[model samples]
Target: MSNAPVYDIDPATFWADPYPDLARMRAQTPVCFVPQLGATLITRRDDIFVNEKNVDVFSSDQPQGLMTVLMGQNMMRKDGDDHMHERRAIFPTVSPKTVKNVWKAQFEAATARALDRLAGQDRADLVKDFAMEVSAEALKSITGLTNMDWREMDRVSQGMIDGCSNYAGDPAVTAHCDDCTASIDRHISERMGALRSDPDLSLIAVQTQAGLDEAQMRANVKLAISGGQNEPRDAIAGAAWALLTHPQWLRAARAGDISWLQVFEEYARWISPIGMSPRRIARDHDLNGIALKAEDRLFFMFGSGNRDETVFARPDIFDPSQDIAPAISFGAGPHFCAGAWASRCLIAEVALPMLFERFTDIALVGDAPFGGWAFRGPLSVPVRLR
Candidate 1:
């Protein structure tokens, strides 16, 4: 291990371009400790599968830290039966049936309206103007927070995710998280009263019916907003980036030679939005020959695992037609993303097709760089939409 290359997981470098560092880690030290993060970074695909699936050995119930701070005591932090109960309660909202029978048209309409707003503009930031707007609107529709401003809700969601990512300790991040939490609390309270007087088919109503207390309801709402908004938003922007940059794939997608769903999958594998997931070792164990003690923090590098050479041929290439394996972007095991169906529909069926239909030609106007070591995606994808 002495000969293993050392990589810094700092904000500046890691977020700038994590692939190279992640590649090195995967090659030399697939399970090595990073002093900066105070945890072992796991980079290989198989290793992450093992870690995510074996919840008994690597627990998701992290004790009152970054995740709990940002998301509260929600399903993301729960284990065993508690996690399943919380997940099942909210499953209907994000299930394939709900997405197909209910949310699909709404998602399409939201994307169409967002694209309509961008009609007059020669150039626009895809992330801000389109992707973020659609994601925020979708969350509003799903949670029945119609009165709340989508932009404000997005700001709160972003703050919670940013605080969780920069969990090492940043005063501004913490303050923003606190403010977001308060806002969520207020929204939850309002929704509770609304449910009593006039109920609707929303996630809040579902949770209320499940008999979850105030804190659990708020935490789960935060989790839904944060997970639902950011990952899918980034997925849209990332798919746009991939398609625009790789014209062949774009042409195939537009010409109906490839399924839009396949394009979305390839984009996710090529540029994972949520790059890493945090886990804690439940007890003393040996992982891929590396000794891990109890309470050891582990950062499962999903972004790296998706691009593992062993998993995908020419892993770096953005080829949607290749026989690509399923990526770990939405994660694995019982903790797999509940919003997966909705996210896929929003991106593949609604957002991507809408962008293509509205714009004759799309090209990057400036450096639309991808960042965020943990939650990765283009910060601003400035494009000329003709």
Candidate 2:
């Protein structure tokens, strides 16, 4: 075991191809202090699970952090009964039943519409033209912000994500986030007025009915936009990139021999979109012999855990047939993403297959470089729709 600090991995290299570095860290220093991140990177699958499950020791309610800065104090940052209550308040809106029944047709239509827009293009950047557009449309429907421009919605969502992921507090990122927050405030206020006059079961309306005040409603709505919009967009692009790179799996997926759900899960594990989640240490504790101090930031590297050799056989391989356990891409325990079902429905069942069906012979134009420190996925997937 190398006792060296894990900050040796360069940020640029890790962003480009993280699997090798993740494998090395998981083997040598699964729970080492990273000076760059100022957090103990928990890379092993079991350790990540333990950290997530033991929320009392590793608290989500950090006094100051990126998530808190961007999302405010929403259900994601809450603990214990408060978390449960707030989660339950919005659970019905994104429940699997609700997503499957209410959002399924909408997702399919959005996917088809996105593909229709790319019909004549000899070469298209799926990330911008398809994935982002479909995800924006879905988010608009989910939040009842259909009147908002999809391009603006995409820009705002990306800004929020980039700001949160920018651990160094980039000025441009902060400005973008500030702008997004102002826009969201206006949107929420308008929606509140509309709901007062006449209400439907959108996410904002449901949260309002569940007794959230204006501030709480705004925070949760921001959370919804950041998580709901960004992750699914990346996942859609990542899944397509995955299948495109590994054509056999793509064929299997199309042939019905392998389920789309399986392909989605594999793509999520292979290249997790939301790569890591932060938790504040409530007290000094020892995790696998490493002493962690109070208020120490702990990052559960879901992307690393997904490829943990101890838990996953041929961890680096992208094989959908293997019966792998559920990845922590959507997180675990109380902080598990409330919009997980909706995200899966949008990406795996609707968007991914829709792209393949529409462009039967789509080919990658060039390399698609995946990026991000906290959130990981392809920046763009340029494809030729022949």
Candidate 3:
């Protein structure tokens, strides 16, 4: 040990290439507490899985925790029985039956509209326009805020989360900001008062009818939009970027002998948009031989775990043939991502359709910059999309 009181885990490494730093961390100390980062960093899948189930040890209840502040106590932010109950209330809405009956067709429609906007363009910033547009629209439908301009909301929310760290300027009073989230709050205030009866499919109705209040409903709605905002866009952008960069995979996808679902599994693993989801301890805890006090934050490196040499062979390379269901990129345990189906739907219905239907070859034209701590993905992916 260098006796360095702190080592600021160079976050920018995640932007350039997260794997190298992750590899170094896993090798040096899989459970090493980085004082600079203000928490323990679990480098293995088993550590994260064990801690997730043992929520008493992990303590997900802290108010200042990332989940508390951003997403609130819908699911990922809480522990034990209460967490289970809260999660179950709205969980039915995302079920396969619910999705097949409701979410999928609407999602495909949104996909069509988004791809229509990009039809004749030779070059496109997939991060800004296409990916974000489709993500915003899909979330809007899922949450029953269909009338809102989801595209702008997605953009602003993205800018805001990216603003969480390293905005490099006055983030508070920044007039040009407040981005998508400000709109969400505005929408809630404007509409929540007027709509005495909730829409049939609204996320609010799903939970409120299941037994919640106006305040709790507001938390769920805000959580739905804010936390749900960037995922589809990031997943799609990163997947498309993954395919574009790896021509061999694209060829395989286009060749089309295997089912599309299989292609998507490869896409999800290969891109792995959300490298980690950060969590903070609600109380004192210990696991995997590491002990921690209350209020200590931990970063669950999902990407690192996916690439763990113990589990994955040739972990660095982007391979479509591997069994990625074992991976935790969409999270695991009780806190698994609710938007996973929608995320996968976007890739299948929107991204791949545009890709397979339109162009022959796509190439990455420049370096891909990433944003956010928990929901990290390419910020702007420039490509020659012919």
Give lDDT tens digits, candidate 3, residues 207-226. Answer: 76787776677666766765
TM-score (C-alpha) between model 3 and the true structure = 0.87
Structure candidate 2, residue pairs in collision: none
**Tens-place lDDT digits, model 2, residues 1-386:** 22326556676777677778788898888788777666778888888887788977789998698868776888788899988988888877888888988888998987887888799889998888888899999998888777678888888888888887777668988888989878987877767778756766677888888888877878888888888777888888888888999999999999999989998888888778888888898887777767778888888899899888888876789999986775787787778888888888888789887888888999999999878757777788999997
Q: Provide C-alpha RMSD values for all models, in order.
A: 2.0, 2.1, 3.3
Lowest-scoring 10 consecutive residues by lDDT in candidate 2?
1-10
TM-scores across all candidates? 0.96, 0.96, 0.87
lDDT of 2: 0.83
- Please write out the lDDT profile of model 1 over residues 64-175, one tens digit for every residue: 5697866677898888999999988887777798889988998889888899899988999999999999999999878867667889878888988988877568888888
Q: Candidate 2 has what TM-score?
A: 0.96
**Which portions of model 2 miss their true places by more than 4 Å?**
1-6
Residue pairs in candidate 3 whose N, alpha carbon or C atoms collide under 3 angstroms: 156-180, 157-180
